[model samples]
Target: MSKPPATILASVKQTASVIFLHGLGDVGASWLEAFNTYRIPKAVPHVKFIFPNAPIQRVTLNMGMPMPTWFDIHGLDQNAKEDQPGIEKSSKYLSDLIEEEIKGGISPERIMVGGFSMGGAVAIHAALTSPHTLGGVLALSTWLPLSTTFPKALISGDKKVNLPILQCHGDQDSMVQVQWARLTEQGIKAMGFKQYTFKEYRNMEHSSCNEEMEDVSKFIVQNLPKVD
Candidate 1:
């Protein structure tokens, strides 16, 4: 399938790129607003931001209602039914986007992949299976999907180490409980992923705030390739 169209925010002198996926029922344009609200472009100059739209499909959790989602949501439980095929497909799509960045002169090490909610789930899946070492992964307001299979799916050893991962979730997030995020951290650690940080915010729900965005900015600045 052809990749979904994106809302591109090109930098004056692009050296690195960030491919961010939107949550269920959201378009790339929506994230563009969030990025603008946070002034992300100014915070991280010379970095292209690509917000890709998820393909529209029937979401099982919503009673087979059609929506733009990274993958199907079979249930809410951590180990509930997962749409493995959809996850794999979206991961391949993400890889293709990364490859396109490489073709445009950005190294895989200079590219970061991230998302919100369901989108974050896809980002985690993609990063875990990626053949190339990414600069980092920003997963916000989300939980790891297919948790039971993650241990066996990880790349293992040094390849998985030193890859920065910023996971921020709300303590009051009813959509994806904070405990789920904790479990995700434990699973990744068990797989020998050392460079991971899980940040929790009080009273925050299934959404992000200015504080979270600030941390996100810091993560981008810290992970992106340093200039001489």
Candidate 2:
């Protein structure tokens, strides 16, 4: 079993949940700390927060240096070889987290899954493949992996195909370049996904900015509001 995720319990009656995943070489604690630094928790005290860590493994992009990675990356190129199996494995873990929430009494519709960069890539995959329809998907500084296999690999009749997706990226990101995000935008459009929002930050790099964080907080609230 994986390590228990860092969590923030809701202040009021819990009705919704958000799971935020970190990027390569990151741990759930760091992400949770950063999240606490913001007003996200206060913004929605009724929403439970979860930060899960990816497993540590060798990364080819970093010359095989071991790091906490959701999946292996052969390279950063848009067309580089992707670790499909690894991605699927990580996606299952995320889905299992969602299952945990559902089993704990939170409805599937009240749950949101999200992540940054590589983690965001897996979020997109897992959200698209889940048998249940979630509240939304939050993908930051990331591109769609296995882009070609999409729409086909996506579940045939799952409501996740129409799942709300908020994809944010830095226009000046040299790592997961803005071009890659644009391609993902085009792909999402081709797939006819409803409720998809793509936000590009000006003068931003691979990292996030205050404006992006503000948008993220709003997205969470918008997707997972208080239930009656």
The count of backbone overlaps in candidate 2 is: 0
Residues 1-228 of candidate 1 have per-residue lDDT tens digits of 435656555556788899998888888878878987888878777788899988889999999999888889888876678898998898889889899999999988899999999889889888888888898999999877778876677764468787899999999999888999998888877777778999999899998988999999889988884553
Q: What TM-score goes with each of the models?
A: 0.94, 0.96
Candidate 2 Cα deviation (angstroms), residue 50:
0.7
* Model 2 Cα shift for residue 7 (angstroms): 0.8
* Candidate number with greatest lDDT: 2
Query: Could you tell me the lDDT of residue 134 within candidate 2?
Result: 86
Worst 10 residues of 1 by lDDT: 1-10
| Candidate 2 residue spans exceeding 4 A from truth | 156-158
| C-alpha root-mean-square deviation, each candidate | 1.6, 1.3
Worst 10 residues of 2 by lDDT: 153-162
lDDT of candidate model 1 versus the reference: 0.85
Clashing pairs in 1: none
